[model samples]
Target: MTADDFRLILFTLGVSAAAIVLSLPFGLALGWLLARKQWPGKAFVETLVMLPLVVPPVVTGLVLLKLFGKKGPFGALLERSGIEIIFTWKAVVLALAIMAFPLLLRCIRTAFEEVPRHLEEAASTLGKTPWQVFSRVSVPLARRGIAAGLVLGFARALGEFGATMMVAGLIPGVTETIPLAIYRSFHAGDDDRVWMLAGVSAVIAFIALWIAGRLTKGRHPF
Candidate 1:
């Protein structure tokens, strides 16, 4: 209702969108690989990918903070380039991407696994390269499921709180998101603001789930 509330909503939406865009390429590649191949370390890789979902969000955030803090190797390198992530808006995106990755990957992998290998083979027989078969036949058939995965991922990003708090401190107009705003509002005894923000988040999440369900046609990813 207030300008600040609207700003938080917009900020959260922007960060969630950025998180989805950042993670999608990696998700697509890993999903296709996991669905189509069985390498020696596949199990290990799968477990690693799912670790964030099972672990405490704070733990994930701590690890990320350590890795991206000023003294950390990556952070130091970035600092030299005049870039910063720790306790900044970028950290919010980082947290959301990491937290949402597993769900996105699961949906995408399942969709890719369901794609008929015979169809790919048929394309190959027609002199289509692997990329062509993937980009054309395989992707087209799996489009609906991929879209579902994206919606789920976006929803997950929107709800992220713990890990985000760890890496991106609640700095209004900078790093604060919907969940963070709710936390601050509740603690400050601003019941009205909290209720409004909660309603907005619930409505957004419901719409996302509805769209995902329709896209997947009530598939497992929902």
Candidate 2:
């Protein structure tokens, strides 16, 4: 592989990792709350979380662009701190996080909901703090599920393209990721490059799925 190809692969990996790291905690927290608590406007929150799954990726990207572009509220605030997300690797992370968060949340919420409430009550009776029970009992029991969610999120991030391209653009060596690289090569008629990158992505995605399955012990039922 050429240096460009290697660099592109590395960029994809880095962005996917960043996306997973950013999305995991938020997804888990939201999912746990949704599972454990009853609150007003819960439906609205759930719909928002699931938006990426249902909305066209291009639309999602466009929304992100508007919200994060220069002169946009959040973008302007971030710009004051010398941080720019639009058309940057950070944009890729944002797109991937948005796209993958729902999947992670679903997995985590399911895991959390499946926990036995009696165990929590028993822990409370034994004088364990709420945070202690959550940290020790609930989390440990759900560790495998959370790991599976992470792997799935990573894989989803790896394959993300539409939203990423719209927000991050295909700036080679700067924000170019594997899927974006494949799209560029294909559109440029560089069939060899396209095939090579596509193969790499497929392999990586397969490996991610394999790891996720092993972590979940095939509990996802395909």
Could you give me the TM-score of model 1 versus the true structure? 0.96
How well is each residue in 63-172 modelled by candidate 1, as lDDT tens digits? Answer: 99999999998999999999999999999999999999999999899899888888899999999998999899878888888898899999999999999999998998
> Can you give the lDDT of residue 124 in candidate 2?
89
lDDT of 2 by residue, 94-177 (tens): 999999998899888888887788888899899999889888887777778888898998899899989998999999889888
Question: What TM-score, computed on C-alpha atoms, does each candidate reach?
Answer: 0.96, 0.95
The residue ranges of model 1 lying beyond 4 angstroms of the native Cα positions read 218-222
Displacement of residue 159 (Cα, Å) in model 2 is 0.6
What C-alpha lDDT do the candidate models reach, one value each? 0.93, 0.88
The top-ranked prediction according to TM-score is: 1
